[model samples]
Target chain A: MSTDTAEKYHKHTPAPIDCNNVVISLRNIRKSFGSLEVLKGVDLDVCKGENVVVLGRSGSGKSVLIKIIAALLRPDEGTVRVLGKEIDQLDARELQELRSKIGFSFQGSALYDGMTVRANLEFPLVRNQRKLTRQEVDKAIRQVLDDVGLSRTIDQMPAELSGGQKKRIGIARTLILHPEIMLYDEPTAGLDPVTSVEINDLINDVQQRYNTSAVIITHDLTCAKATGERLVILSEGKFLRQGSFEEVFHNDDPIIKDFYNYNFISDS
Target chain B: MKVFFLRIYDIYQFSLRFWKEAFLPPYEYKEVFNQFFEVGIKSLSIISLTGFITGLVFTKQSRSSLAEFGATSWLPSLMAIALLRALAPLVTALIIAGKVGSNIGAEIGSMRVTEQIEAMEVSSTNPFKFLVVSRVLATTCIVPVLAIYMGFIGLLGAFVNVYNNEQTSFVSFFQEAFMKITFLDLFTLVLKSAIYGYTIGMAGCFNGYYADQGTVGVGRAANTAVVVSMFLIFIEEMLIVTLINTYR
Candidate 1:
């Protein structure tokens, strides 16, 4: 994949990883909120440069799973290792260090409302990598905005942008850090169909361009189908199946059939 | 009742976390200055107006009583003692508790509900240090300064009343006012204002940081921040006055 943004911005090579090496590994993860068991013994892994999409309905604990992987939430029972370090064992400073290499794109885009697009993108870079000069920061911001195709919205606040534009900027903000892994929570949750497709294309574009491993959590079938190199269906706090989109859905189980019917019916 | 106690305990824990994070390096100086601008500069007009009105009204009301006793000459000294020792700091704090407290609550609450806090965390930015510490430190540092300003403005308002009634000169009015005010009174004013500022900042940050249930949570956070800060401010005022009185 040709990365015009990477070439135009300051060029630096990412640390090499074997293509088959797993960057994110989760085993027997369990989480509960009060009386509700949100995630019950789940396990998953993603190799370097792979886009693994976890498809689940609302309240299926897909978000919890990702948060655990990011160490935002502690698992009740499990081991979560990201980029070769055990997430739970790392102290605050170590966790922060680890998190710098992982970019999380929130469900609502989560751009800072008080900041302009440029400041929003600059925030992570300036905070995490404090040595970058002003010109370097501006150049990187321009490159990511260009990559996300919203260079014109640099001066606008998050509220001024359309939903699609906000999503692009959110991705662009995460990409600015040059993360080794991207965790996207519902990248196309509330956009129009056309916009959803555009976001899916952007997700794929980011994966190819940045060569970052990713875990995309969403129930949107089109998004899963379009961006997921491997797809897993999360149901009742556990993964029901994992494979290619077609393989996962090709089942006689009532649950799988129901999921397919619901999505297909809704899409149609 | 159990839930209430739990909430208090949570707030206590949250305050401890703030102290721990506050001393850590990478101090977010830019954000602290921004919050100072927000808390101090933006709030100047309202604080000034409130201070002036308080001084004017309190003096006006007290004048009839003083005249009844033929002690009208004591008005400047009495007004000075009242405004500097109590009214200025308490009223300024309550106003700020309402204004800046609610703002911090709603802003951080909205950020919490929308996952912007989580976004900050994932980006390797300490959201608590960036958001809570900066606002709390700003309020802690600025509220004392504001209270002192209010005290001065209130005296000016009292002077206006004194001048109108007795043709007193500005210097004489001020001299009379300061006659009864001890260094202890000034110290109490500063201490009380700082405590109230800390209370307001902590209440707002705690409610907002832990806000839930989406938009409704944001509104609740803002409302709770004001009520709790005001309640705590009153309690703090009473305790500090009691303690300072013993010293006198």
Candidate 2:
């Protein structure tokens, strides 16, 4: 049964948060699966053009938080608002329209396996963007391919691409929509260190080039350090800390320090 | 009994969701056509082959029974009625339930495990339209046509049986067979096949879309899809026969 706690406001926030200019807002967000509570009264606010990286060990509900932001999963309690609109209030059409302005990039790229790279890039535009002419569709496809530096592989099927190439195409598919908010789930996961750095750098480039605000959930410190200006370490279902990268990186908290040190928890 | 009732209620809700989403705007026309080709044209050869074998076996078996009463001349009329009104349609639907049902279930279940379906939803694409609706509508439209094709091919198989018995003329055999058949028989034939089509489509997608287990879960979905759809086809045929018997 759903708890119907969607209207509950934050009761134990450490400090008052400024909500003005916030693109994504979660107030007392709580989610549980059976007996295990993955998120317990989590609160966060991401503003325009800001990149907030959520750091966590495996199974810390980092991915769940990102899914909730997209309204893909509803919280058992508390309110979620994306782009200033309450997620629970939007109708199906309104939700789709809202989603068009936001992009979600999954770790495996989640590219449609049956589609070629050209078709994968064309999917969102063909599905949602009705005003784009043929020329515009081609232009958008070419631009995003160029942005991801995968223009040569446009005609290649997703199966033909390498792990890093798939992730790049995954990001590029999201970028083609020119989303105002990008929700990335472990963009650098399952890649070599050099490729991981390349992807992290590419994410920074997309932020500048597309002027989009982003929420990245990762356990990799190198990925977090490279892409995140501000960082929030999630542990035991609460925000352990949130501040500029240097502020969280150098803090003396043992738990926060462990999150940084044990970044490869999921590697095994 | 309790678990069975619960399953029935769950399927009812699942079917209701499909109907509600089906009527919504932003339908995927291209995807629907693609599904038609996948469900219809791809299924023809197998359906035809099955239909032919079924007609030959049933006609040969029935001839031996009629010979006991020296009523062998009634063979063509009886063969046509049985094949057209029941056997061909039901058998064709059962085959489709096996082939198409398992396919939809496995495909969607794999997509679920891979998070492709979740990705589609997050990207604001109505996967219900692109995946479920296209496939369901294709089956609904195509299965009835396949059933009709099965009936026609089975008649040819019966003609071969009649030739073995010295009836010898194709034209005379077809004329005699169709003479006793009524429009009501044909109507019920089409109606039953369409219902069977709808059942397979719904059962396949319902099992697949809700599959939560990993790879093993996908296998369970495919298995359950074929089993449930085949059972539904039998239930529908029984209902159709009862209705026809009651009114006619």
Candidate 3:
């Protein structure tokens, strides 16, 4: 961390932390499409203001697990609870209501291709909270855009943005609702290494500033190390190993070591 | 043939899920307006412009056949009847199935394949309400309006063609043309347009929502959505015509 950034962190008192307050919990979750079981009997818990990252190979269902936590996909079996409310049982209306409190960043920079950057950021805010005046919404939009370092691109469309810029705008749009938990799917995918570092820094800064927990899914080991305090490797449909980043990194178990060393390991 | 049947079954399931997602809503108005502007208005000029030329060219080609029987005076009524009954709605819908329907399918299919839809799910926003319902409702509500616009333009095109070919005042032409059209005929036209709109919207959304595999899956969804919806529209039109004639 830079001295300038460290000083800023020291200057601002961190938000109140509820170490034991579980904001999100998933129990024995399972999902399958046809005969392919993507996630099988997975369990996870995220505390308030925690940064938890799921790491795995491309198809190990790390992303699927996060999606289930977000309540986007229904589990074939088990329960997911967000903000202490069980989500899987909720009807569509209730699900939408729950979504406003959670910010999600898509892997592909899923900004509406035709909408301007400002308009893209304004989408969830305008839809969920219609009571905000145009000025109020604009003010918030400017703040979030500035935070993501894309204020100058407000008038530009998604097609005009670079990959890094698109991801920033996607993050800004995610912040529109001031969600309690930020969900990121491969936030740094396809970016240059320098841009990837910048995005990782931004993720860290946002988590501290907003005091929100994060559930990040990524295959990039650099990103996993840079952004996460807690790391877990997902293998098959279950968590193969999980611990603090340093612990997971230093562990010498065959699967963990093989995963770190990039050795192919067949299912035994 | 087996794949086609499986696809039909899949589309049926997709439509049911879409409907369930649509009404149970925290609605996403931005996506709705975005789709409406694209699918309904952006495609308008093409549909109307094509309808107009089709009407004019039909008149030019059929004129000789009518004159051979000395039925020239019946041309106005015949044009009006044809435009209102089937040609306008059927042709306009086929064009939309190719244009707007495929666009919807591809857009949503790409979202699905890329895991963007999954992102929306984890963020607490119901992807169905935000993505699927918005496009479906927008298309359903706007297609009928497009049909009406196309029907009017087609009549105007026929008028210009008739005037260029033979001297006839606007008042006389409308008087003769409208004489044969009853409230029933107009209602039937509107009803068919509404059904076409529903079917087109449903098919496009279904294809996109359930699109699996990868890039190839999205392409197939879009292609199949257009072809199947077009076929269904024609089949339904023929069936409606038979039912109407049988009752008469």
Q: What is the interface RMSD of each candidate, in Å?
A: 0.5, 0.9, 2.7
Candidate 1 Cα errors over 4 Å, as ranges? A1-19, A266-268
lDDT of 2 at A223: 75
lDDT tens digits by residue: candidate 3, B11-67: 777778877777765566767898789878798889878989978888888789999
What tens digits encode model 2's per-residue C-alpha lDDT throughout B165-246?
A: 8656999998989998999989888888888988998888989888887999899999999999998888878888998999
Docking class of 1: high
lDDT of 1 by residue, A1-268 (tens): 1212222221222223355799999999999999999998999989898889999989999999989988889998989999999988899999999999999998999999999999999999999999999999999999999999999999999999999999999999999999999999999988998898889888888887998999999988778877887889899898989987667876787887777677666432
Report lDDT per candidate. Answer: 0.90, 0.85, 0.80
lDDT of 1: 0.90
Model 2 gets an lDDT of 0.85
Top DockQ prediction, candidate number: 1
Q: Which is the winner by DockQ between candidate 1 and candidate 2?
A: 1
**For model 1, what is the alpha-carbon lDDT of residue A70?**
87
TM-score of chain B of each: 0.98, 0.94, 0.92
Error of 3 at A151 (Å): 1.7
Residue pairs clashing in model 1 are: none
DockQ of 1: 0.94
Q: TM-score, each model?
A: 0.95, 0.93, 0.86
> How many Å off is the CA of A62 in candidate 3?
0.9
Minimal lDDT window, size 10, model 2 chain A: A1-10
